[model samples]
Target: MNQQQFEKMKHGQGFIAALDQSGGSTPKALAAYGVPEDSYSGEDEMFDLVHKMRTRIITSPAFNSDQIIGAILFEQTMDREIEGKYTADYLADQGIVPFLKVDKGLADQTDGVQLMKPIDNLDETLRRANERNIFGTKMRSVIHEPNESGIKEVVKQQFEIGKQIIAAGLVPIIEPEVNIHSEGKEKAEEILKEEIRKHLDQLSEDENVMLKLTIPTEANTYKQLIDHPRVVRVVALSGGYDRDKANSLLKENDGLIASFSRALADDLNANQSDKEFNTALQNAVDSIHNASVNKK
Candidate 1:
């Protein structure tokens, strides 16, 4: 889709999920999950597999085919190949839109979120991708402030960050969450929803309304977050490295989430244990599909 088309997505309710494929996630398995093998863990050997998975998604009547596959092109090893395919001609040849995710994640001064800090190298990365004719992009900025000041800080920082991006012609996914738990986790999700809405509304004025968002299932159910009119989309990010819980959450939400992914993908990317990771991912997909069918 074009930039204008993407901007119009704000009117489309329900969340867009970032399909989770991390931690020893094999291309063969991702193929089974409906993502092209070439799309992740890049290998010419699995090009056919990737093609098959994508084709299935496109043809699947049960699943939303506009589904996004996250972290596919983010790997440094895969950039060279993917960027080549992002060119205008390459786009025409492929006949598919790639939603690039850019996020300058949180910094706790230590720990996992902090360690990944100065995240998503958004500016320079998108510049290169845009030059490669890679147009549509999504930036997921995770801010760690759990109180009002943190909320305000996230709004200001994300706005400044987003203004720079929209000017350069890329979409930003404004994701400011209180990690898995924060001072407010004990409060209610409305606090999180309200905080997110404020950020999004403020960011909405940044150049255009093209900024897409990923609202966690935790936040929603914790406070019945989906009730917000401003929350145009929902995203279920895998949590605590548990597939059963992740799948259970997916079923609980009734396909409201359009995307799903987690740190497991990081583990997969780094060549970590793929056994438990793959099993969890499969359960999530199965649960989501079952939930979609029976509304369970």
Candidate 2:
């Protein structure tokens, strides 16, 4: 592990940017940026376009470690380059830590939750990520209701994979997201917290991990996790919230910081000139930064 990057993540006063839109979510992400489905001919062109979008964001003057400590990237982005350097290397050069999203995607919903599909060649992927200078990895699971067994399975799978990532000398961001609009959202969060605590307690003193959760129904819902000896940081996903609302909710949570994807790209448009795009991105970065570091 890079000690400098680890320290920055452990105590950095900024938010992480989630730029890791995988195959299923790529079209939606591109459409929001003003690229319609018809604009691309096939998967190749689609990924190429999304890569351009990411390159633009990374290269913009508005993005830097000052207010953005790290970025989570799709596997394709990790394999590609920005300005002739591998994506992770480029992020490091700009003082931003880079992380790769390693999960294939969600599995079919069962037991009121969707666990991550089994990741094939995970060790190989970890090796490649390490070779490219990535600092960590992020994987996601989803919960639709407060079913104890289901949520337990989600967390278990996460930590199991997390250990693999750790053995490879990288930290893992274990994300088990509760659907924001679920009928028993608060109840689900309550169960989720307890399950996470059990796993955190089992960690060896030298081992550490990060958490990326949905913005809870109540403020400080994950305070214990945030302060856990084994937890390096706790970040919140926007979970379909708009930027303004996401920032508002994040402000009420004292230690949690943002790891927003759609919210960060909400105001940006592909047709905008560089000046316009930069200004929009700057505003988004500023608002998220304040919400992350200036908690109410």
Candidate 3:
């Protein structure tokens, strides 16, 4: 999008809740919530639960809180409605920007690192995002270790695709996620930061980008990025950390906000009583909200 859009997001001072897991992740999440394997047999069945989750978030006070300015939605949820309103529209009405996950999932490993599946027809995807009034998009690629060459390759590819997304008039959240449990996590982040710098350095002074990074070992590893002219925001992924630990780590980082999936919904499961679910979600939201406001 334009600088104004990015500026609005920056001013919002919040994180993104990544509720866009698809396929296996969807069922796994449901099952964790005590939904039985036999509970849902198809994509439609699984999506019904997702929609309900969105509904909960939208109608809850947490959704209206200033701690969250946007949400990342699965393609299925893009057109889905809750309470007779399109999900995206629902988010917009609440002042939360809607962003779509456009990657096709992981492809074959490249030098022991898994790259994101190619965007088969990105123009069409962007078209849908546009029509849905989505404010931005997120794509993910994985870095397994501190393999400099592999990390560089993944970052390069991410930026290449990101530029195209920017050209399409939508902000792109370039997510080159480093495995948190991988060895040499700190060094890996250093390498990834350098690679990202290469891409940012190439952008014209007027161009802007946003990053969805894994929380680094060093709290301020991304300070340079936070200060960069073309960098709008630097957000972190939970990267499978539990909600408490995720928030604890996130709070230590300066100028980094969250875009969490598992952590954001850690306590939300199918088994919880409605009251219990709301309490758990509220607590989770509070932690993330507090961390986002601590902008370092």
Best by lDDT: 2
Which residue ranges in model 1 land beyond 4 Å of their true spot? 1-72, 75-78, 82-96, 109-122, 133-145, 181-183, 186-188, 203-232, 262-286, 289-296
Task: Rank candidates by TM-score, best first.
Answer: 2, 3, 1
lDDT of 1 by residue, 28-65 (tens): 45644545544555455454343433333322332232
By TM-score, how accurate is candidate 3? Answer: 0.94
Candidate 1 TM-score, C-alpha based: 0.56
Estimated TM-score per prediction? Answer: 0.56, 0.99, 0.94
Write one digit per residue (lDDT tens) for candidate 2, span 150-209: 999999999999999999999999999999989999999999999999999999987899
lDDT of 3: 0.82
The model with the greater TM-score, 1 or 2, is 2
User: How much lDDT does each candidate structure score?
Assistant: 0.43, 0.96, 0.82
**Deviation in angstroms for 198 in model 2?**
0.4
Each candidate's number of clashing pairs is 18, 0, 4
Q: Lowest summed lDDT over 10 consecutive residues: which window, candidate 1?
A: 263-272
